[model samples]
Target: MATALSEEELDNEDYYSLLNVRREASSEELKAAYRRLCMLYHPDKHRDPELKSQAERLFNLVHQAYEVLSDPQTRAIYDIYGKRGLEMEGWEVVERRRTPAEIREEFERLQREREERRLQQRTNPKFSSRGIRPGLTTVLARNLDKNTVGYLQWRWGIQSAMNTSIVRDTKTSHFTVALQLGIPHSFALISYQHKFQDDDQTRVKGSLKAGFFGTVVEYGAERKISRHSVLGAAVSVGVPQGVSLKVKLNRASQTYFFPIHLTDQLLPSAMFYATVGPLVVYFAMHRLIIKPYLRAQKEKELEKQRESAATDVLQKKQEAESAVRLMQESVRRIIEAEESRMGLIIVNAWYGKFVNDKSRKSEKVKVIDVTVPLQCLVKDSKLILTEASKAGLPGFYDPCVGEEKNLKVLYQFRGVLHQVMVLDSEALRIPKQSHRIDTDG
Candidate 1:
């Protein structure tokens, strides 16, 4: 390779290759390689003009490499998220970083999240209510398996109603058997819906129905207008009632429809109604009333449970602290040995209640600092915990007693600062980039 890097290679940003060391190389190893390269490439050692220029270029490249890789924090940041991470605004919270695989995964993850937010913007749902009319309706559904589902709906009001349906989904088709209530509508019906195309851009479906709604058949399709809107059309050809065309416009969770009956002359009829189901009401109720009530009720129940288990929890917490005190001496020995070499180190750790939880609703979140215990648990720079509940681990206790528990850890592995939060029931394996904290080093 030439002493002077080409524009393309500079853009490629493969500094480790120029340094002649592996990505996982130790800092001391990298320092040694940098020194050797500098000694061989120093401009002052060259005699001829061309050699001096080449040596100058080589020495400059070597110096840049040393500047980047010599510092532990900068090197870790560069190794994980790349140079862009070093320049990004608010890099203190740049979503996440991984083991030198951040850019593609981060871009893809953000794209998916943005698409979901555009499509599922239901914070203010425009619910379509099909005229509730002071009636009581109950619905129950069960998923039989991956491909089959059954439903039962019962409504009592001016007219009694009971309906049952069993639906099965195949690769590109859906089959449904329905049992309706009234005379002609009471007949058993089988319906089939075939999807011609279903993807991000377009969704096309053709359906055939019998029994409750006569021998009706229709084909409908929805096409993406943009991230937040969709346009749809459906054409139906029935027996005596003739043919109909429906045009639909969908914006987020809200949908508008215009239905027209096609006469013999192929013109539209005056029977167009643009009303949607009253689903927004339920969403509003859930957001405005239901969630707060449920949360308050949960807190009340949790308080009662905690009060009942107060004494036991206190005893367990004392025991955990005692266990942590006993572990400090051995943990210091382990940390000293770990520091001598480059490996994983427990910078901070806590168990029981979550340390990162920012909820202000509860004043007391009982977490035991288990940094010593965790350091003792680390073997050969790797920390592994069994699949069983971590509450049973040494130096751990049920901080919230009757509530869910989490273990929060902040650790440095080979110089990279990483943080993770794990549920009590989850197994733990340290130094995985998937659990890396979204913070600047």
Candidate 2:
């Protein structure tokens, strides 16, 4: 029986190519080739630091290849299964043939181990923390009179913890420094603002500010009314005590505000005002003209997504049925060939199913029977020469970007069983000799 192997050990390295020798080279020839390559790539032969580093890496790979190919038992395993076969611990040669079920169980076990390892890596603190990012922003604006103002801001991560500096020069010179901390739900800020006027009335004004607030220096509270609307209020107490009430309706892009101010005197006098005459007209136009247009667009997008999902489901079902029909016909032909004394027999094969990208919410995958393609290839060499598009198999769709496609095959040759894995069907060629070694004997 074959032993368990780790996913990392399932490599496709060509040991013979590394040693510059043929696949059928004898043990002596393997050793001689290893020695020659080892001497040429040995780190000790290089003096430059970068060159030495590269040489050391090459030397390590060469050493590992030689170690496996030099041992008689391991070499036999390598000849069939390549790197993955030797990786199986306690693996031993057996006289009995392995069944398809047993081979499939072994593959499933390796897949489970790989998934576990991936989850562990994702949850590791060091790995998760590597995503923290830093950013900087600067903005400058000028009027027709050439009065200019600008600000520089720096932020860390996605939170409100940031630093900002502002400078302005017009009829007055203004400079401000601000710092914010904590998150958007609850945050605080400290700011210092200074303004200097140079005219008939030369005046200097400044304020030292501190608040648990929103934005750079405004203290406010807001509530989301719906998917697109909000209501909020802010109050600033200073020489001119002020109170502001804001309402955003229809969509957040449009807003209306009411401001009330009180003078700090013995008899406090209050004044109320609104600067939304033009904005009132704008909002009216938006509601009457833009809202319906935007709503229609949103509905169209949703309908498109639903149609796309339905189409994908239909396509997959049809493909699966077609693949099954093709497989049945191919199997019949293979049976006829075998009865006529042709040297071909059915083995094991696996084909994964295609899934809708929109419906893929997890890592689970579904596979179907694909032993038919392998069976057909055995009888007609021309079958292996077809394009990837016309390989006449089901579930051979190109994976979405960032995803990988793989095919696993098991076959018997010369009374010996073998297994192989192909990464993608981009090149629908027969499995090469390098992929024909049986890792699980």
lDDT scores in order? 0.63, 0.47
Candidate with best lDDT:
1
lDDT of 1 by residue, 101-148 (tens): 454556567865664444333211121226545357776766665566
CA lDDT for candidate 1: 0.63
Which candidate should be chosen as best, given TM-score against the real structure?
1
Residue ranges of candidate 1 with Cα displaced over 4 Å:
1-186, 191-277, 325-329, 332-347, 352-364, 386-389, 401-406, 410-441
TM-score of each predicted structure versus truth: 0.37, 0.26
Deviation of model 2 at 427, angstroms: 2.0
